[model samples]
Structure formats: structure tokens, C-alpha cells
Target chain A: MKIEKTEHFLNFCCEMGRHLVQSGAEIYRVEDSITRLMHAYGYTDIEVFAIPSCIILNIMHEDHNYTKSIRIRSSAIALDKLDKLNNLCRRVCRETPDIDTCFAQLREITSAPLYSELVSYLAHGFVAVFFTLFWGGTALDAVIAFASGLAVKFANTTLGRMNTNIFFTNVCSSMLMASVPLALQYLGLNIHIDMIIIGAIMLLVPGIAITNVMRDMIAGDFLTAMSKLTEVLIISLALAIGIALPMGAARMFLGVM
Target chain B: MLRFLPCLYAFIACASFCYIFQVRKPRFIFLCSLNGAISWLVYLLTDFLPVEAARYFLATIAVSALAEILARALKAPATIFLVIGIIPLVPGGGLYYTMDYLISGDFAMFTAKGLQTAAAAGAIAAGASMVTSLVRMLTWRKQAHAQS
Candidate 1:
């Protein structure tokens, strides 16, 4: 391949890898997909390394080397995009499509529309309501959880828009999670405060992070595993502190504890 | 019939998560939610286990195994299913009670609840990793044989 073409291919590979990571693909999957893509293009001497927040791709062609690294600042669990990306990678590997065609498809996948915000809000509410009922919460408790869940989702989106860090975002959402139920309880309504809080807290739990941490460990990507494990611990601590604050305040002022 | 209410709730909860995680396909959403219901059902049926962690381990295994099978059949990544399917067993309640005990200044109950919560989380991780490793080993050998 010409030097110019090689550079473009290298850039495409890096972007693909970064997208995979940003869509919550495991580290090993990102590395494997990039390596396979390069191999399909007849580039044998290529190395791809990916962690949760960064990806590095190096390729040796002719007498020169091309390297690119992208730093990913945030990721969300978008399985729909992940599946589309995985299929695109497999198709490209099998057919050896032209670089331009491949780039177009990648753009299409990334730019695809997601569920609207109203649907997302309803999802959050339903998750909380069902989980509250699953844990034996009464109908009243589920009703409270539905409202709190909506509030938590709103807080998360608003804080996220301000570019606030995840730790603070979680703390604020969890604080909202606690105070809503506590406030309701103090209002002389008979509700299972514990169940309502747990239901709302589920919206903020690091379920994806926890699952990825173990999978990374199994894939022998200990560095990525440790980073994600640290994330899980920090989020858990933030949640505890968030919940503690409201409860402590309630006990001190309202004598509710 | 009444005993299976929690499983139904788990099903709906996982379906909602499918939306939250942007799993767009209707078929995929149903399969993912079915896996969640199966995991919770397994947990409920294993009430005979002496330790709570053991029950959680069983449930996690069920989820991981089903997720692997679904990934193979659908050609999608197993992580999509595994993450949502395991949510019902994530010990959110334990974390709440642990915090509650701590806030109330009951150190004894706090310690016990905290350890139990840790044990549940650890068991979940162990169960998932074990199944994933097993699948990887089997597939690696099959690929090697084919190449040879």
C-alpha cells in the first residue's frame, strides 16, 4: 500500500478501536478487532493495545512506522452500536472493502440515532418501579420509586451536560435518590423507604463497570481490570456518602432515623 | 404462581434496562430479559443453599452460561446480555442495608451486612469469570485444531 493510503487505513483502524472502547466493548475485543482488521488488509506487522480510556495502534509498513493514539474521556453502554460495529468489522474482514466504503459505514454506525430522551426517562422510571416491586416493595413504594427514578435520571443528564466528573455526578444522583424517599417518608406517607431508595439507587449502580472488570481480568488485561475495579470502588463509596448525607441530615433535623 | 412474581418483575426490569442500554432490536430485548428472569428464578430455587453467596454464585453461573449461548446464536457480543441479565442479582439491597446499619451506629450488624455484601459481589465476579474463561479455553482449542 502507498504511504498515503497506509496512513488513512491506520487512522481508520484507530477510530474504529476508539469507537469500540467508547461503546463499552471489552479491552480484548477492541485489541482483537483492530488486529484482525489490519490483518485482513495484509498488514502483518501491526500492534493494537486498548484500555478503558485509551487506545494505541502501531503499524510497520515499508521502511516507516505509523502510530496513532486516541484518549477516550467517557463511555456509555450502547449495545446496539456495539453489535453494528462488530458486524461491520466482520464484514470488512471477509470482503476487504475499500477504505472509503469502510469509513462511510463507520460514520453511519456512529451517527445512528439513539432512543429519545422521553423514552429514556420512562425506561428509568420503569426499571425503578419493577425493581422496587421485585424486592417486595408495596405499590406505594413503587410509585415513590418511579418519581425518584425520574429525578435521578434528570439530575444525571443535567450534571453530565455541565461536564461534571462521574464521581460528583453519581454523588449528586445518589443524594437525590436518598432524599426523595426520605422526604416522602417525612411527609407522613406510609412507604418502604429502604425499598424505594434501593430501587432508585439501581439507576446509578456501576453494573457495567463491575461486569467489565471481571471480564477484563479473565482476558489477562489486568491493567484495565484494575482501573475498572477502582472505578467500581469509587462509585460505591460515592453512593454510600451520598446516601449517608441525606440520612444523617434527616436524623439530625427531623429525628427520622 | 405467586412464587414466580419476582421473576416476572426481574423480566420487566431487565427489559427496561435493555432500553436504557440502547438494545434496539425487539428480539434481542426479549432474549436478554428472559435471561434475567432465568437467573432470578435460579436464585429463588436455590434457597436450600446454606450460604447466600452460594445462591448468588448459582444465579451468576446461569446468567453467564445463557449469555454465552445467546452470543453464539445471535453473533452479538455476550457482554450485551451478561451485563443486563446480572442486574437483578447485584446486591443493591445489601448495599442499602449496610449503609443503614452504619448510619444507625450499629457496628455489629454493619460489619456483618458489609461482609455479606462484599461476599455477594465477589461471588458474582468469580462466577462470571469462571464461565468466561471456560468458554475461551474451549474455543481456543477448537480454533487451533481447525488451523492445524
Candidate 2:
């Protein structure tokens, strides 16, 4: 490969790694995918390293080393996009497609549309309702949880658009989650406050973070694992504080514990 | 019948999560939701276990194994199934109650609930990692034999 083409390929590999991490892939998967792509392009001297928030790629060709690094600021789990990207990588490895063509395909996968906003809101509501019922909440509790879930989703998207940090977003949304049911109880509604709060809180839980942390640890990426574990703890603390603030206020002012 | 209501609720919740996470394909969504149901059912059946965390551990082992199999059969990543499937077993309720106890000034109960939540989370991580490592080992050995 020519020097210019090698540089483009290196950039392409770095972009792929960035997308994988942004799609919430395991650290090892990102590293392995980039390494395999480089080897598929007939490069023997390439190194790839990825963590939760960054990827570094280096390639040596013709006594010249090219290095590219990308810093990822945020990520959300989108399994459909992840599956498409995984397939694209496998196809590129098998066919050794031109770098430009590969870039085009990557663009398509990344640009794919997610479910509509209405669908997402409904999904959040249903998740809360069903989980409330799953935890022994009554019919009234499920109804209230469904509404609270929609409110939480609205808070999440609005805060997300404002580019607020995740800790603040979670804290605000969780406060909403707790206060909604407390407000209902104040209005003389027969609802299970704990059940409704748990349901809405499920939308903000760190289940995926826990799963990814374990996988990263098993992959021997102790640094990534520790960072992600810290993320889990921080999110959990934020959630607990968010809930405690509202409950404490209710108990102190209204004696509504 | 009535006893399985929680499992049914778990199924619907997981299916909804599939949309939130953008699982997209109908087949995978249904399978992932079913896995959630299975996870809760396993948890319920293992009520005989002495420790509550043990039930979560067993449920997670089942989820991880099923996710590995589904990934192989569907040619998709195990995370597609594993993340959604394990949702039902996450200790969201435990975390909430722990905080509730803390707020109510019940230090003894708060401590107990806090420890229980931590143990549950630890058990889940251990279960998932153990199964995943075993699968990785088996695949690695198989590839080595193929090359030899």
C-alpha cells in the first residue's frame, strides 16, 4: 500500500474502533476487531488498544509508523447498530474491500435510524409498568408507574439535549421518579409508592454497566474494568441520593413516610 | 398460573427494553424477551437455595449460557441477548430499598439491605464472567486443534 493509502486505512481502523466502543462493545472486542481489520489489510505490524473512553491505533508500514487516537465522550448501547457493524467487519475481513468503500459502509451503519421518539417513550412506560407489576405492584400502581416512566423519559431526552452530564441527568430523573409517586400519595391516591419508584428507577439502573464491567475484567483490561466499576458506583450513589432527597423532604415537611 | 405472573411481567419488561436499546429485529427481540422470562422462572424455582444471592447466581449462569448459544446460532454478538436477558435479575429493587432504609434511619436494616444488594451484584458479575471465560477457553482450544 502507498503511504497516503496506509494513512487513510489507519484512520478507517481508528474510526471503526471508535464506533465499536461508542456502541457499548467490550474493550477486548474493540481491540480485536481493529487488529483483525489491520491484518486483513495485509499489515503485520499494527497495535490497537481501546478502553471505555478512548482508542489508540498504531501501524508501521515501510519503516514509517502511523498513529491515530480517538477520544469517545459518551456511549449508549444500540444492539442493532452493533450487529450491523460486526457484520461489516466480518465482510471487510473476508473481501479486503477498498478503504473508501469500507468507509462508506461504516457511514451507512452509523447513520441508520433508531426507533421513533414516540416508540421510545412507550417502551419506557411499558418497562416501568410491567416491572412494577412484576415486583407485586397493584393495577393502580402500574398505571401511575407508566405515567411516571413517560415523565422520566421526557426529562432524560430534554436533559440530554441540553448536554448536561450523565450524573446530573440521572439525579434529576430519579428525583422525578420518586416525587411523582409521593405527589400522587399526597393527593389521596391509593398507590404503592415504593413499587412505582422502583419501576421508574429501573429505567436509570446500571445493569449494562455491570455486565460490561465484568466482561472487561475477564478480558484482562483491569484499567477499563476499574474505570467502569467506578462509573457503576457513582451512578448508584447518584440514584440513591436522588431518591433520598425527595423522601427526606416528604418525611420532614409532610410526615408522609 | 398465578405463580408465574411475575415471569410474564418480566417477559414484557425485557421486550420493552429491547426497544429502548434498539434491538430492532423481531426474531431476536422475541428470543431475548423469552430469555428474560426463563431467567425469572429459574430464579423462582431455585427458591430452595439457602442464600438469596445464590438464586441470582444460578439465574445469571443460565442467562450467560443461553446467550452464548444464541449468539452462535444467530451469528450475532452474545451481548445482544445477554444484556437484555439479564435485566430481570438486576437488583434495582434492592438498591431502592437499601436507600429507603437509610433514609428512615434504620441503620441495622440499612446495613443488611446494603450488604444484600452488594452481594447480589457481586454474584451476578461472578456468574457471567465465569461462564464467559469457560466458553472462551473452549473456543480457543477448538481453534487450536483445528490449526494443528
Candidate 3:
């Protein structure tokens, strides 16, 4: 009886984590790991948002029936649906997300509460920093700029399913950063294009597809990973061109030469 | 500090820019702030660090893993944190500079620098993926063993 209960819980955790990703949770990889832990617990029906991050799973050793190793393995990413609703209210004062309604919807979709959005932010920051030193400072500037823009595109596409205004996001940011060299010259901040490396470190923020591909690959879902990665490459290419187009145009028009 | 303002603001702008994509509800402002801080911190560290070449790889791993952990703890998705945090670290400008170099027919230096930057990026991914994938693979293998 205990084993069955445990199995059910494990399955539930993995399922919810999976759903979170499918529903476009930003932190799919984190969910992937949490679900894996859930699978180990033998809890086939693990509900994340319903409970807290810590869930106890007991391992039954056959040699001694009474003496079972009570392992308290914990899973993270507890959304606390109520908190999300409140947070939603604070953030969007005009239109609050109805907690009761959101919970009902969750029953159909099977996801965590909403706290995991914090984790997604960490992932974005990490990637942004990592890309900063790829080239000298000059090259780094442009890349950072693009990653910042791309982060939005990926975020919108994954979670909100909104258009994200990919085109202008890049144009505006790049246009701002493009003038780094010349603009600084006027203010006695005569820095080289290399100085912009820190500026461009955010350009190729590969959040959506990277997380998706990694999760799919880990789950033994090779097809999804491949497709997701291909999509990443395409998005990446588009992102590359976005900045390039504006920079190219500005130079020609301004006669930077 | 003032010199870094443009990059900083650009990073913030792009980091918050995701609200337009994810929910369009403005409910994600906190989410946006969190992402912005993480990504900005990483980018800023990379920018200020004295060790230019080798440290980039380490910084990438540090940032990515942090995002993963933060995601796990926050009950949100890793994408939220990672996406925002990654804003400050992309190398879009490098490709531009390299292309500009080529466009100007300064093939030798520009091409070489471009390749170097790409390689640096590869190094970052390779390091992070190695650890994350290995742990994941091992965790998976152990589970498969248990099931079988």
C-alpha cells in the first residue's frame, strides 16, 4: 500500500513538472530535474502547486519489513498558487488574476503554482554573463545587446505566447548601443567598440529553445530536442540579422567612414 | 560607471522587454526584475573582471547554474531567470564587428577575432552542458537501473 502511494506521488511530480514545461514554464530544465526526482519516489501523481517543495518518499527494504529507510528527498519549485494570484494583483492592479479561476485552469493543464518565474530570471542572467567575453570588448558589446533583445523574444514565445515585438526590440537597443563609440567621444568617454562588449553581452539570450532542447534531450525525447534546437538556430540567425541590419543602415546613412 | 550606463539600461530594457512576449499582463514585472538583476549581475561581472579570456567560460557556467537553482527554488520556470540574466552576456556585437571588418576588406584580423569570439562562446556552452548533461545523464541512468 505504501509503495503504491509513493509511486503515485512520484508520477504526479514528474507529470506536473512536464506540464509546466509544456505550458511554457521558463525554467523547463529545473522542472525536468525536479520531475526526475519525483519519478524516483514512485509517486505517479505528484502535485507541485498543491503542496510545498519538500515531499517525503520512503524506500522499503524487503529484508526487514518494519525497518524501512524513510528517505525525505525534496523537490523544488513550489509555486503556491495563492501567492501568485496576490503577486499578479500587485503587478497588474487594474486586472488581477483570479486565484480560484487560475487553480481551476491548472487542474486541466497540470502545472505548478507560479513562483518558478524567479528561477527563469536566474537562467537569463547566467547566459547573459557567460557570453560577455567571447571576443574583445568591441565584439562583446554587440553580442550583449542582441542577447538582451533575444531574451524578450524567447520569453514571449515560450510563456506568454505574445508577439514580443522582436523587430523593434533589437532595433531600439542596438540603435542605443550602436552609438556607444561616437556618443562617448562627445562626453570625453572615448572608448573603443570593444568597450561595447559588455553592452552586447545580452544579444543571443538562448533561453526558450535552449531550455526546451536540453529538457527534451534529457527526457530521451530526441525528436523534440532536435526540432527545438533547429528552431533555436533559426531564431538565433534572425536575431543576428536584426542587429546587423540596423547597424549597417546607420553606418551608411551617417557616413561613419 | 557612467560609461556602462548605455549597456546597463539596454540590458534592463531588453530584460523587461519579455513581458511583451510571455504574458502581456504586466503581472510579470517582478519576474522581469528578477531576470534583469541576475542577467545584469553576470554581464557586469564579466565586464569588470580583470581576467578577460579564460574567465568567460567559468562565468557562463556560474551564471547558468545559478539560474537553474534559482528556478528550482522560486517555483517559477528557469527560463524566466535565465532569460533575463543572459541578456547582458550575449555577443551580438562581436559578429557585427567581424562582419564590418570583412566588409571593409580587413580580412586577416577581423576574421581571426570573429573566430576567436565564436570559440569562446563554444567553450562556455561546452563547459556548462558537460556538467548539467553529465549530472542529468547519471541521474537518469540510476533511475533506469532502479526501474529495470
DockQ of each: 0.85, 0.86, 0.15
lDDT (Cα, 0-100) at B84 in candidate 2: 95
lDDT by residue (tens digit), candidate 3, A147-225: 4434543543353344344444444444444454444444454344434433343443454355446545655556546
What is the alpha-carbon RMSD of candidate 3 to the true structure? 12.4
Candidate ranking (DockQ, best to worst): 2, 1, 3
Local accuracy of candidate 2 as per-residue lDDT tens digits, A22-130: 8877888888888989999999988888888888888999999999888999788899999998999999999998999999999999999999999999999999999
Give the distance in Å from residue B9's predicted Cα in candidate 3 to where it truly belongs. 5.8
- Each model's iRMS: 0.8, 0.7, 9.1
Which regions in candidate 1 have their CA more than 4 angstroms from the true location?
A: A1-3
Q: Note the residue pairs that clash in candidate 2.
A: none
> Candidate 2 on B14-36: residue-level lDDT in tens?
99999999999999999999999
lDDT of 3: 0.46
* Candidate 2 regions with alpha-carbon error over 4 angstroms: A1-3
TM-score for candidate 2: 0.98
Best by DockQ: 2
Tens-digit per-residue lDDT, A1-257, candidate 1: 45588889998898898889888888989999999999999999888888888888889999689999889998888999999999999999999988999999999999999999999999999999999999999999999999989988998999999999878998999998888888988988989888998888888888767767888998999999999999999999999999999999998899875
Compose the digit string of candidate 3's lDDT tens values, residues B85-139: 5444445555566756755668897878688766655545554455466556766
The first chain of model 3 has a TM-score of 0.40
